[model samples]
Target chain A: MTAVQWILENLPQILELTVDHLLLTVPAVLAAFLLALPLGRLAVRLPRLREPLVGGIGLLYAIPSLPLFIVLPLILGTSIREPLNAVAALTLFGLALMVRSAADAFGSVEEDVRLAAVAVGHSAAGRFLTVELPLAGPALLAGLRVVSVSTISLVSVSAVLGITSLGSLFTDGFERGIVASIVAGIVMTAVLALVLDLLLVALGRVLMPWRRPAPRRAGSREPAQVGERGAA
Target chain B: MTSLLEALDWVLTADSWTGPGGLGVRAGEHLLYSLLAVGLSALVALPAGLFIGHTGRGRGIAVVSTGVTRALPTLGVITLVALAAGIGLTAPMVAFIVLAVPSILAGAYSGVEAVDPQIVDAARAQGMSPRQVLLGVEVPLGLRLILGGVRLATLQVVATATLAAYVGAGGLGRPLFLGLRNHDYAMMLGASIVVILLAVVLDALFALGQRLLARRPGTA
Candidate 1:
């Protein structure tokens, strides 16, 4: 059957798998982001912690996803078939990547701005929330975009472990020689990643209303440039 | 703890170490695939990236392609190719090369772009051709970041090459998928341990190489 016809007939299964894919991805990315924020800040704030923190993260990130998934069940005391194992492994992968970006994001905030907030009698917490976080918003968002895309793609790998994500399509399709289902999975995954990326961009706009598209002129810096630089 | 010990026992078994499907043979296959992919990818991506970075053109292509490729699921790529190619080395190799190209491309361009503009101007002022400037000046200075990209790509290929087993191509993944099929967790864990060790050892070697390159007089 043609790939199009195959997809049309399997739409329900496809939808179910997409939901499974998102269930694994969204939580993992969110948890990684939330946890990475503090860890990244500590890395930046404590010079002593910077090397080991980032270095260790880089080391862990180098582990293959399949192996990490296989070994995680043992480490987390979860059953081999548990989806939680997939989520935890993905969180580690995402967190490993995002921590460096998070550090660079917070580090990108100017010292002058922090001092200025302090000079105006803002408490340490207040300055971080009002001055530092907002100023670091663009870079953090850029980092988050990478994490989200990566997590979304990596979710499919869990299907091989029988955890059931869109990746299941690939494994099942290969077994049955169904090219269409595999194609559908690939398209759906890319679409999910694109939609999430756009949503994050929109969210960034709403959260930082001051950051409009920079006017292109001889000297004006482009906002898109910031996003590029922030990515690894 | 018991499973971990079982996995260790599996690894230590002489039978698991010597056969056609043994860890040594599988690991050699994995290494061979990874090296070919990373090497071929660098050959294609490095010059293109250097050109873009040096000329300050096609930066958009680099950025967009990198984002798109990064979003492509590794499993999907390998499975699809393996299906079409009839389950051989071709699919995994193609997928690995595809996976590695963007990284090496991004690394080469970014490394060159990160070079100080004043230095490029100094080389140009000395009447050096663009080729001479790129090779003699930018490449040497940017060697650390450039090699950093290769290191990352190599590691990625090594890790992903395990998927070759899914397509009936041999690698350490042979035991992994075999264990999965037979419900052998110890075998799965054992193979995974070897894969992880390979990655770590290669990573350490790359780290050492990067440090040595950095120590060269011109690189810093």
Candidate 2:
């Protein structure tokens, strides 16, 4: 059968797996974000802690996914088939990526802004929330965009262990010799990643409206620079 | 602790080092797949990326391609390709080559792009041809970043090559997937430890080379 026909028949199953994939991916991305915020900030705050923390996380990324999925059950005392194992591993992967971005994001914040916030009597917490975090917002979002895409993709590997996700399509399709199912899986996974990324971009726009670029004026370079910075 | 011990025991056994499906064979297979994939991908991606970086053209394509490839699930790609191509090295090799291209491409182009334009201009003003400028100036200066790309691609390819076992292709993943099927946690852990060590050693070696290159006078 053609790919479209196969997708039409398996729509419900595909949707269910999509939900499962999202359930695994969304939380991992958010948790990594929350965890990395402190860790990234710490790395930025203490120059001495930067190397070890970032380096350790980089090493964590080097661990192959399948083994991590298999061995996590042992580390966490979870059952072999536990979805938590997958979630935890994905979280580690996401954090490995996000922490570096987080550090860079926080580092990208200008010192003068921090001083300005302090001179206006803002406390450390206030200054960070109001000044630094907002300034770092775009870069952090860019990093999150990457983390989200990768986590979504990585979630599929957990299917080999019988965890349901779009990746199950690949395994089942391969075993059954149904190319359509595999095609469906690839398309759906890519769609999900792109959609989530667009959502993030929208979220950034809504939250950081001032970041919107000014309309182009012929022969003017300043607005173009602002646009480039915003895009970055 | 017992499981960890069992894994270590499995790894340390002389029998695990010899014969078919042994660590030696599996690791050799794994490295072979990784090497072929990365080498082939670099051959394709390096020249293209370097051209793009030198001319500052086709960046949109590079950006979109890298983004799309980064989002591809390697497991899905390998399994799908394997099924389509029938059981053999071809499937995993194709998947791995596809998986590896973006990183090396990004590395080559970005490395070249990161070179100061002023330096390129100076080289040009000395009456050097664009070809000469690219070969001598851009390639040397960008060598570290270009290697960084290859390093990342190698690590990624090596990791993903483990999936070749799913398609009946031989690699370190044989022990991994086989252990999973048979409830052999020790074998699983042992194979994982090996894979992790392989990645680490390669990453460190790449990092050292990058450092040494960066330290060279005028490169930085």
Candidate 3:
């Protein structure tokens, strides 16, 4: 069948799966970020906690998702049929990735910046909120973008365990041997992921204006140096 | 603790190491699949990245490709390909290549771009060809990053290749999948240990390689 014809015919089903894909990713990534922020901060604040906090999560990230997905139901005493299995599995991965990125984000904050904040009569909590987190925005947002995009992709994996999502298209397509459905699923997933990534990039620009390139004159561009701090 | 011990006991048993579907055989299949995928990924990405980095072009392509590759769900790709190809090791290998190429490509180009221009200029002043400069200077300087990306890709492919079992392909995931299906926890734990151990070993081996490739600051 022609690709356009197939998409036109399956528009309703496709739209439903698209929603499923978004539902699988959006809340899970937010939950992971919520868990990761404090844990990532703890890793930075306590030198002794760094290895276990970061390394342990990294190890958890290394565990295959399919097994983890299977094992979560066993471990959590939840039914395999429940949506919790997929959500928990994706959250673990997002949490794992975000912890390291969050630590790196906070770590990227300069000592001078902290001292300056303190010198300005800011309390510890106030300084962290007003100075440190702002400085860490670029790195933190970069990490979030990665985790969020990968999470969107990973929602497809849960289809194997029978959680209906855009990935179900691939599963059902294969079972029914409908090549058009599989291609449509692949195209839709790719478009959704790219759209989400671009959205995060745009959000980063809006939220962290300091990270964006400055408006320049139409002519007379200067190549001052490679890798120099952007004219921030 | 008891489950851990039980898993170790199960793994140690001779029967687990015997037969066509034995742990040893599975490990071999696992290694072969991962190696093939990594090798193929490096082959495709390294050249493209090298050209882009050397010529200072295709940055957009690199960025877009990496982003897209990172975002495409591997499980979907694997099952779809497997379904199309009618089952074999090929599906998982293709999926691994897709998973791996972007990192390797990103690493290669970024590694090249990171080379101090003065070094390249020096090579040019000394009458070295562009090829010679790429080979003698940029590649060695960038080898660490390139290998770092490969190492990361290898770890990922090793972990995810186990999903081959979902499509009726064989690997270390067999025991885990079957064990989960049949309520054989020992088999699950035993196989998981093997899988994790393999991943750790790959990680450590690359760590050592990165160290060995480390050139002293004053020397090449």
| Candidate closest to the true structure, highest DockQ | 1
Residue-wise C-alpha lDDT for candidate 3, range B145-204, written one tens digit per residue: 777788878988998878887678888988877886777777787887788788878888
Over the stretch A1-232, how does candidate 3's per-residue lDDT look in tens digits?
A: 7868888999999999999888888889999988988888788888799889988897677666766775565567775547877888899999989999988888888888889999999998998788988888888888998888788878887776678889898888867877778888888888987788889899888988878676786654545444321111
Query: In what order do the candidates fall by DockQ, top score first?
Result: 1, 2, 3
Q: Residue A63 of model 1: what lDDT?
A: 97
Which stretch of 10 consecutive residues in model 3 chain A shows the poorest summed lDDT?
A223-232
lDDT of 1 at A109: 86
TM-score per model over all chains: 0.95, 0.95, 0.86
| Candidate 1 per-residue C-alpha lDDT over A1-232 given as tens digits, one digit per residue, 9 for 90 to 100 | 7889999999999999999999999999999999988888888899799889877896789899999999998889998789888899999999999999989999888888878998999998898889989998999999999899999998998888799999999999999999998999999999999999999999999999999997778646655443342221
The first chain of model 3 has a TM-score of: 0.89
True contacts kept of each: 0.71, 0.60, 0.38
- Model 2 Cα lDDT, one tens digit per residue, A1-232: 6788889999999999999999999989999999999999999899899989988896889888887887787789876577788889999999999999999999988888778899999999988888989999999999999899999999998888789899999999988999888888999999999899999999999999988978997767654233321111
Q: Give the lDDT of residue B122 in candidate 1.
A: 80
- Model 1: what TM-score? 0.95
CAPRI grade, predicted model 1: medium
> On residues B123-198, what C-alpha lDDT tens digit does candidate 2 reach at each position?
8889888889889898999888899889989999988888898999999999999998999889989998898888
- Order the candidate numbers by lDDT, best to worst: 1, 2, 3
Model 2: colliding residue pairs: none
